[model samples]
Target: MIRFDNVSVTYGDAAAPAISGVDLTVPEGELVLLVGPSGVGKSTLLGAVSGLVPHFTGGTLRGRVTVGGRDTRTHKPRELADLVGTVGQDPLAHFVTDTVEDELAYGMESLGLAPEVMRRRVEDTLDLLGLAELRDRPIATLSGGQQQRVAIGSVLTPHPRVLVLDEPTSALDPAAAEEVLAVLQRLVHDLGTTVLMAEHRLERVVQYADQVVLLPGPGVAPVVGEPAEVMAASPVYPPVVGLGRLAGWDPLPLSVRDARRRAPGIRERLAGLSPTRTGPEEGDRGADRASVPDGSSGTDRSSATDRPSGRRTFMPLRGASGGRERGSAQAELPEHLAVTTRLGVRRGRAEALRGVGITVGAGETVALMGRNGAGKSTLLSAFVGMVEPASGSVLVGGLTPHRTSPRELVRQVGLVPQEPRDLLYADTVAAECAAADADAGAEPGSCRALVGELLPGVRDATHPRDLSEGQRLALALAVVLTGRPPLLLLDEPTRGLDYAAKARLVVVLQGLARKGHGIVLATHDVELAAELAHRVVILADGEIVADGPTADVVVSSPAFAPQVAKILAPQPWLTVSEVREALR
Candidate 1:
């Protein structure tokens, strides 16, 4: 249905082409997953399908891209609206209406469909995406994940033959992501629709893909093959694939069921060895004393101000017989850094958060997880004073966040919001770094250096808007970290990040935690939480339902468990690293 013949795209002022010599074909009624590292032209490749490339993006097209035998060069995006439905990474940018129902119907109206037909399609889409309850809510009042679903429903309502999605499930929780993927499966199997999706969270979508397209990097030809073949050598992959490779399986398992069928052999090899559990050291109470600005032990402080200043030291724990330890108390305890009491937040008539209470500790990484519209983003907003609490109080270092001034807040806390573009306004990356340096009062080139650490080889002259979703996120994170705030908050930090980029993020965040930085991130990436988070907090209907150590929280909830945890049931292992260590 979609064909790229010797395709190459180069934007103005770019030294290299975004994509080059990409000759590929996606058969009709099949789901093709586009995979690659950050900024490797996955988005650019998707844009070519919907006629967004070299059209609305202002780039030069060297070769032809066709959808349904219709050349994109001859058909602009508007002309191909009925044939192709494209949803970008930022859903808010795609909406033209105020309410969920209106947004879903907007595309059908544009296509000049009958009113009755449009209404029925809108209702079907709302039910298919589980957006029926949110149909009357205004787009502005909805959460990031809700907005993403609305954007997808809006496109789906049009009933286009081809659907192009960029990070379609990035903002969705595990359950919601499953719903979206199931809907896509139905479209491919029952309706004969073609889906070309580019996503960074391979763990969520790899098994569902009919085929895989791996773009190694810029200027490198893409490799298209079976999912297993591509992931074996692909720079980015899911944990299950990593486990299969480690176990020397003949064919790498794509799903948990397949992995479990082969798990008996591996389980026997490490029969009595217990999984290693790592966390904050016990009896190291003074480890974070320097993080308290006033040297007070009480939780009266509003925010933390001590920046992360040291490296992390890892120590392995063993039993008396020199075997790995399990169910240790030190691995589950948290050193408190900030606490909230009966927090309540209201946005207009909506109770975004109600009696939400949680604590974050220095050197601890806590993941806030829930379904869409569950107040994860709202809670994060309250921590940074972007949203004021209506009833309860929040105490960071010793002060209330809403009462703190912007100048002081930058030193106390840093937030990488859901919309990375909201933190960027400068034209070029160099300018953005300079502005961040001035705002944070950091040394010259400090922000730029941080950006390099997160995203290497990106040109200083590149426009911030021109960068990929993951690159933009990295730049925003660097801009926020320039202040070296003791508390760091991230909302969907891995929205567009590939495995390589996410690995780098894990290392950076771990380093910051070792240096006494308290990290609270609201995310839908379960693999990330399993690998990095020390604790997990699950929110639902604007209230906290569960909070505990990572292994306990995730393993108890089937929807939130990682691939490894699910495959190795009856075992306490949460990650591939844990399994590998146990085997060793």
Candidate 2:
């Protein structure tokens, strides 16, 4: 379906080519995974096929890229629409209409298909992607996951044989993401559509992938093969893979189930094997303990608490619960931080949760998971009465956020919005954080001391928006921490971070969790959900579908299941150390 012949692309710079003399071919109906560290040109490579590299991004290109035998250089994005449909990591980045139906029909209309044809295609696409119910819903109001599905449906409507998605599910919670992925799988299996997807959270998608393409960061050749080979070489593999590798298996296993089939001897070999690095002690604050070179944290968990809860569990996590947690949310509440809630929410077009309660127990971290349209942000905003649930109860310590004379929720509940940049106004990271603290009424000494602990070495002179994407994210995180809000509402915390950055971000959140604060964060990172979430919940079409321990919710939905390594080798493990112990 797509071919790159000795392709090398260069942009204005004093450096090497982004992609150098690469030759690759994707068959007519196949799925390909594109993965590498941030900025290794994974996006650039995908763009080349769609003619976005030289057309939209503007870079000199050498060699050839062809789709359906037509040269990419010969066609612009508009010209290539029939053969290719592309979805990026950010859902909002591609919206061109006000409602889901209009967005789905936009591409077909541009293609000049007859009105009847356009309508038919739009209806079919909507049904196929599970957007029929949301057809008339405002695009602006759709949840992140729903919006992404609409984007994909818009392209698939054109009946393109090949679909390319760049981190399409990066912004969805586990349940919602599962719905989108199921549609993708059905298209591929039932309709024979070809797929090329790029993503950073390998643990969630690796199991379903037909093939794995591993790129070892910048200036490295792409490694394409079975999922096991590629994932085994992944410096930052999933916990289960890290464990399997430590067990010294001949070829690393891909899914946890695969590991199981090959586990007998390896398990015996790993038993009681002292890991090279003990990594974080139980009491150590979460930090970037890069267990492996790729942030896979290859610590061998030769001695972790054995699973007392027999790995089987059925949790009822319903209603609004979605966050970008790629880790666990353990309750370690401190007496100082408390948030209380009683059935809080926005029902229909009005507020509900009248007796709606709110609470953040001492040292407990909870995530408010839900679909995009489900009232996650609204509920968080309610901490300060941003959208007062029509009727409900709420309190921050002794004061009700709404009834309180002033909006103390600003200080009591720190917020890191989905678009972190929106919270930024200062010229530098320091300035932005200082402003957040000031708004929170925090003492200067308290703000500085607390912010410094989480974001070390960042300065006030560095523009908060000017920093690298990762740095900007850290800056935003710092800004919220400075307020010392006992209750935190973080929305999509790890949207664009790379593996290393994600690992570090998780460590910071974990550290805070240990410090005793009640947090309710929403995210689309399932691995983050499994690792860091104390509990997991699923939301679909504005209602909670599942809830309970992270492992339970994720495992129940095959679409959100952890990487193959987890299935192959069953162990309550996150890093290499945990895996080592499971094997032992």
Candidate 3:
């Protein structure tokens, strides 16, 4: 469907190409999964297909890009609209209509599709997307996932032969992400539509991808192959995959179910290597992270040797006397905030929250999850006193947010929005955090100490707004965390961060949870939730559809379940360490 021959794009004022010398071809109906670290120019490849590269986004193009035998330069996006449909990370930016039905018909109408044809196409798209019931609903009323589905549905009405999506599920909850993936799978099987997509959360989606395209960092050639080879040998992979490689399996399994079915012998081998749990890796995740020194980090890193010629024990944590519980949070502290009751909220004409409720006991960590538009943010905003619900109330440390002034509440419940750039306006990272300290009545020295520790190497002179997306996110979070708010609300906290940075955030949030600060992490990365959250909550149509222990909620839901590995081990496993623990 699309082809790249010796393609290289060097953007404005840059010394080298963002992506250099890449040659690739896409057949008529192949779904290719593009995987890589951030800033690797994955978007550059998509831009080439859409005529954004060397056109809308200025740069020098060195080779030809062909879509359906038509040069992208000649057949711009408008010209190729009937052949390709593209969706991006921020779905809201691409919306062209007020409601779901209108948006779906917008693309068709632009093609001069006849009224009868347009109507049928729109209705068919609504049904295909499982969005018929929401056909007339305002676009703003949908969840992040629903909006994303609408975004794809809108473009697909033209029946484009190819679809390109960039991190489309970054902001959706587990269930919604699954729905989107399932919908894509059905489309590929039924309509024969080809797909090219980029995603970071591999543990959830890698099992089903047809092919994986790895764009190694900036200025490197992309590597493409089948799932196991690309991921098992992946320099950039989730920790669980690392555990799988250490297990000495002939072929590394992509999902936990695959890991468990082959684990009986793997378990015995793991026990021989190390009978007890070990601490985290010393350095950043590298080929070296797998290179454990003195079998120290390896007391349980892997089970590569087949019993060292003989040994066995599948679920090691079950029998270990000293290993810690996988999902265990630290003992409580009296200083942390305690939350109880609901935060009522309304967005325009929609009743986003109708007697919706939540509780965060001191030092507990709770993950807020639900399909898009299920009122996660609205509820978060209400909790922080940013939005006023029509009724009900929120108590932070036994005090109503409504009773506290906006400025006063700022020091009580700290909240971070989905987009980091929106809340940041400071010229320097130092200045941004200093202001937060001022608002919280915290000492200037203390604020600087907090920022430096959270994002080490960051100085007072660094411009907060000028940093990379991950840096900006970290900076914004530092400003919020500086408030010393007993209760913390983070909305998609790790959206653009890399693996090392994500690990740092987990450490920070977990540390806070250990210190007895009530924490609510509203996110779509189920793996993260499983690893970090003590409990999980699911919402749909603005109500708490399910709430309980993380394992219970994840195991019970068909769509929201955690990785297959967690479900397999007889002993509970949350993080990759636990998976290793269970194997040992």
Candidate 4:
């Protein structure tokens, strides 16, 4: 139902096309996954299908793009609204109504559908996406993941023939992501709907795609093939595929189930070899308290300790001062960079966090995980002083966060929020970095250097708005790091990054941790937690449900386990790198 003939898209006065030499035919009722590294024009290609390219986006589109045999070149986005549904990377930007129910019905209303049909479709969509409980919630009050589901439900309510989605599950938890993907599967199989999706979290969606379209790089010809064939040699892939490649499995497995079917031999080969844990020892604070079997002993119980009945409350940090003497302050800083005791936060008649207690030590990385609206982001906000606690206390570098001045807070903590663009206002990347350095009183090249290390190939002259979602996230992270705070907080840090960029990020964060920086990231990327985090903290309904060693917390929970852990189950392995290192 969708065709791209010799397609090439280029923005104004660029050195080359953002994407070029693209040609493919997507049959009706099939789901096509667009795979590539960040900033490779996957979004551009998806835009072309929905008639946003060269029309609403003000880009030059070469060749032809047709949907349902209707030429996209001649049809504007509004004209094709009935036939096409497009959800961009940012869900907040897609909303046209205030409440969940309104947003879902707005699309159908725009299409001039009958009142009865719109009401039925809206209810069906709310149930399909698990948004029934949030039907009356305002769009602005919902969590990022909730907003994503609402955006998708809005599109689905219109009953369009084609669905073009960019990172549909980026903000969702594993179970919610599965629910949304399952709905897509039903639409494709039961209703003959066409879906073209671009996502960075390949681990979540690769197994569900009907076909894979691989975009190698900017201006490079596209490669189209079966999911397994394309992923075998594709530069970017999920952890399960990487594990399959490492084990020399034929026709590399796309899902954990497939890998498990072939894992018996590898399991025996890895016997007596323990997975590597390079971070703090188990004796450190926040370590699993239960007498779980260590990997070295060849016992693979994979069970982490349950939540402690009596949570530990830390004393406030000491010697924290707002002064110009950076060296003196660094020496006086306590081991606990951040501490929260029975923290409670309320937002708009809802308790966002309840009785939450956590701690972050110097040179340690902790991952905050949970389902959508699970209070993960709210906890991050509490740390950064974005939200005031309704009860209990929060201390960062020995000082209360909400009571501290903005200038002093920058010296103690920094946060990269879920929406990276919120921290960037400069026109160009160079200007943003310069401003960051100036604000933090750092060396001239400080922020620029971090950007170079975290995200290579980002031009200094590139506009922040023009960059892809992943690139924008990296730039925002670099800006936050410019201040060189003792504690760093990241919300959905890997939202748009591919495997390669994410690896670079892991390396950079690891280096920071080695240098005594405390990092707390709120994310749904279990692979990232497995690869980089020393501790895992799970939240549920505004409360801490699980907090322990990374392996223990994730391996035991089927919903949050990484692909590598799921495949290598009955073994304590968490990542392909850990397995490779153990074998070596």
Better of 2 and 4 by TM-score: 4
User: How well is each residue in 316-389 modelled by candidate 2, as lDDT tens digits?
Assistant: 11121122121322222235454444444654564433333344554455555655556565555566544454
Worst 10 residues of 4 by lDDT: 295-304
Better of 1 and 3 by TM-score: 1
Model 4 C-alpha lDDT per residue in residues 58-134, reported as the tens digit of each score: 87999999999899999999988999999999998898888999999998888789999999998899899999999
515: Cα error in model 1, Å = 1.2
Ranking by TM-score: 4, 1, 3, 2
What is the C-alpha local distance difference test score of each model? 0.81, 0.61, 0.67, 0.84
Q: In model 1, which regions exceed 4 Å deviation?
A: 281-336
Give one digit per residue, the lDDT tens place, for model 3 in 379-409: 7766665555577777765556656654444
- Model 2 scores a C-alpha lDDT of 0.61
Badly placed stretches (over 4 Å) of model 3 are: 238-240, 266-338, 342-350, 397-399, 426-475, 496-499, 556-558, 564-569, 581-584
Query: Among these predicted structures, which one has the highest lDDT?
Result: 4
List candidate 4 segments past 4 Å from native. 281-330
Point out the worst 10-residue segment of candidate 1 by lDDT.
311-320
- Against the hidden true structure, what lDDT does model 1 obtain? 0.81
- Candidate with maximal TM-score: 4
Give per-candidate clash totals.
Answer: 9, 90, 7, 0
Q: What is the C-alpha RMSD of each candidate to the true structure, in Å?
A: 8.9, 10.4, 12.5, 8.4
